[model samples]
Target: MGFRKGISILTISAAFALALSGCTSDKPAPSASTAPTASSSPSDSGEGGTDAKLEALGLDSNLKFKETRKITVEVYDRGNDGGTKPEDNFYTTYIKEGMLRDHNVEVTFVPVPRWTETEVINNYLAANQAPDVSLTYSYPTIQTYANMGGILDLAPILAENKELFPDMFEYLTETNIYWDQDPATGTLWALEGRLNVLNRINTFVRQDWLQKLNIEPPTNLQEFESMLRAFKDNASTLLGADADKMIPFSTSFDVGWRADHLTTSFMPNDLTDKDIYVNGFDDRLFLMPNYKEGIRTLNKWYNEGLVWKDFPLYPAGDTTEDNLMKLGHVGAFMHNWDYPYRNGDDSIHASLQRLVGPDAAYVAVESFPNDAGVYKKFLSGPIDRKVFFPATNKEPIASLLYVNWISKFENRVFLQFGEEGVTHEKLPDGSLKTIATTGEKIMNSPANIDYTITSNGINLGDPDLTVKSIANGYAGVDSKLIEIAHKITTNDGRIGKNANVGQIKAEDGQGQALKEKRDTILNKAVVAAVDKFDEIYDSGMKDYLNSGGQAIIDERKAAWEKTYGTETMLK
Candidate 1:
């Protein structure tokens, strides 16, 4: 509990204590890593200095290095109680043994409890003892910190040192700034880490169930409905005696995106489309016409017993689905983040093997298009994690230099895969062979380096190589499963962007509360009776808007108008 955790043996939760709760990706790659070869773009200027020698220490002429520079970082010590100290872990060891010996730098990793990451980070931030840089999954937390001036604005350094992280900088440039706008300056305050770039959420169907019931995979809403109906009809034979208990479809309570897939077709991004949008602060969706229709469609499914009866009460973060999916009762899920097929051994492929047998298969189907003839999908691109710097960090230049240094090829590899022979072996094909079977120990091992180190992707320059490496990582599972995701990303992808334009300062504090309020009311309305939906939704909408929703909209509208022209904001 004390902030002075200098090699403190703190009992913590799982290794994912530092994992961000906001946006998630396929539970970290299966030991896939970035290579040291500068096959991609390597920068020479900014981030310490533009010269290659300066690239080593990432130290600018202004930063005079002493005999030893003790740079503290918030390291994720999975708290496995394996007696591995934060600084002694393989990832940390790489820094001390390999990279830091010449520079005489002491990198201290302050163990960040994985379970209560937000609170822990906030406590550290408040006390001015937060690590030099911390990687968190929560963007809202980053936004708040930047807004409150608890963190330094990266825009200045980023502009000056654009050459230091050329690949990452180019990535941010192409991706529209990763949506990390500081409320005060309307600029980015934190470094963005990209969990996923391509590939939208796949609509996973119970292929075995479909085969058992002899129903084809749905192409559109009508076919989707028929498939759901078929599952409902043949539940006993297909899903076993628990047929009566089977849920055709369901979503989570906190972040119910199952219906959002349907809403995507109706939700337009720009002024050219018929659907009106207010693109600010998580895109205030209260007045969207398509959103209501999306809910209405779900309500129909609920009345027909296609959707789960308890969806409204189903808790968030895989609480309900994890249990329900194992029972082999849920027929389909739309908002599956990392479609189980793509993951390594513990993916959906293996899960079905446990529940029904190895023969069980989930149909990897194309996303269904709405009545408007468009398949809507939420955007997770630009960035996923917020890598931030605290104002209290003493080694500002050293910290930024470290960032650029790690972005370099060799250091990047060490941070990700660790020493080749020790933690992983170099394959004849130039790929990595991880000795550790568990996802945690495979790549970063003993430390949450991949999660805590930087915001870069697994493959630095080549995306195709990245895909192939990802599939290979899951060599334990069917390579085809992971490949399907990449395949879908290239083919008839129904990715819709919900305008990740700018941010409204108002949306940070009370705005989140209002958004959750809207989600709660929307969930209730979706499951409500046909006649009662309008009543429930209307009353709730009135209350939500009056309480804080209108103010959020007003502020967001003003911001959007000020950002994009009035025509774009209005139309």
Candidate 2:
């Protein structure tokens, strides 16, 4: 409790923490990591004198090594979906050149499958072939490696080289930088990436369908169910020839992710901090109290033929669910706040307008309310991704320097919004407007997030600027609609408490495997017969507990009690 923490472990309650700032195709083979080499002194920096010039521009050349320091960082490989190799695009090239010109660092990127990132990172760690700098969504993976001494303890390096990472420190701040600190030892293995935009999930319904049926948007669970029934009963009226194809509610194999708002709505609002930390093993709250009833509700809908029956059949990346939604066969569903407006011309909204009718559109709705009668949203904390250095990283300073350079305002802005008149242009009001581009300059990821490892979302260095730029980023979507959806995402949002307890050993090596088991449980329970819903769900949950769920719960509960005994630990 006495150690440096960004936010207090206790007193983190159901308050809206809103800061309105705010992959691809190639399947390129990963580059091999080489041995670490020594760096040259500032005086030995080559006759090109780039370091001196960089020094002249306010950079501390003394902080940089005179010789080139080579380090590899992990980048997600989405299999060329953005029309360029994920590992070697214009953005990656820019990063390599920028790091070299500014920090005398030669950077290479190692690509891992985006969807299967945990498995790939695990394999790399096990084989001792991980990139010098690694990034992952799963903090447990880093902890597991750290437990086995495969991760570098960044505390000393960061403390010893404070001047080298001022931008990183400023951007991430204490809350994110020390998010994963070991409570007992005061050691840190990873730094949390900052999420500028904090909006969570929302339920979306077809406004056109609602108008056609003359049914007002539902405001609660019972009304929501009734609305779904209306969609099913009037499928023939809405779809005519495609009535049979109409899925009143559509979701995928990852039910917990797609339908999270529904389950969280069932979670009791009075849950204690200890209760949340203990049961919050997976991202989904499937193991939370009353969550089974939420699954049972879905099962009831599934039996009545209101839910997507074939959802469980499709796996990740199949695109079956997306294709259904875009074709306008899906009446309503729950997903990210801006799911409909992404990807510009290729977005779901665009596809729906082209395939269905111009009048058809998925609009955000507020239908689910918790036991306390408030719409409770368990939003992600300020942290986004976990950035760490592998034990094999000999150039820890260089890696930190590279991350620091990326976190700087000027560098990250260019990465997010490319050259003017190309990827983006400045509006008359001084806000950035992204434009579609082709050829070598095309951005491989939205906002060039893949390359900006230390930061997430649009941060134009000011709160108002970030909010305006984000609202303007959606090309065809109405800015009003985006603003409304943004409000909905942060409505009654509750951030989970980051208890300063030491690593939960059970969670160290079990994130991915337990996630698979958890998904199987939710997927099976949703499609089971109504009479067998409880039985299937209970049995699957029992199996999940036996397969490491119970251990994580026990560890978290014990850790909480050990730190704060007999107290709810709320603000």
The estimated TM-scores of all candidates read 0.73, 0.88
Q: Per-residue CA lDDT of candidate 2, range 1-571, in tens?
A: 1111111111111000100100011112111111111221112223335444334222344455566778999998766444688788888888899888887789999988877899999999999899988999998998888877778766544443344566887788867877777766666778889888888787999989999999998999998999999999999999999999989998888899888888888889988777888888788887888888788888999999999989989877677788898888999998888988877777788889989887888888899899999999987778888998877776666788888988998999999998988888788778888876767887666787788888889999778878888888877777877887888888998876677778788887889988999889899999888888889888998999998989989988899889888887655
**Model 1 stretches astray by more than 4 angstroms:** 1-64, 71-89, 92-99, 102-105, 108-129, 136-143, 155-188, 268-277, 283-287, 312-320, 411-436, 443-453, 489-503, 563-571
lDDT of 2 at 286: 74
Over the stretch 1-571, how does candidate 1's per-residue lDDT look in tens digits? 1111111111111111212121211222111022112233333323322333342433333333444566777766444422356555555666655336544556777787654576678678768778876767666666666667666655433433334454454443434343454333435556655544455556677777877777777778778888888788877887666777888886666334555556655555432321343433344345665567767777888899888777666543334565577567788877543455533344556666777887676655765664556554444544555677776665544565566555555566555555556545666656664433442344323213343355444653566555555555543456675566555543534333434445555556563466568788878887789989889978987997797667766875665566565555222
Q: Name the 10 consecutive residues with the lowest summed lDDT in model 1.
A: 6-15
How far residue 470's Cα lies from its native spot in candidate 2, in Å, is: 1.2
Query: What range of 10 consecutive residues in model 2 has the weakest lDDT sum?
Result: 14-23
Q: What is the C-alpha RMSD, rounded to one decimal, of candidate 2?
A: 10.1
Error of 2 at 386 (Å): 0.3
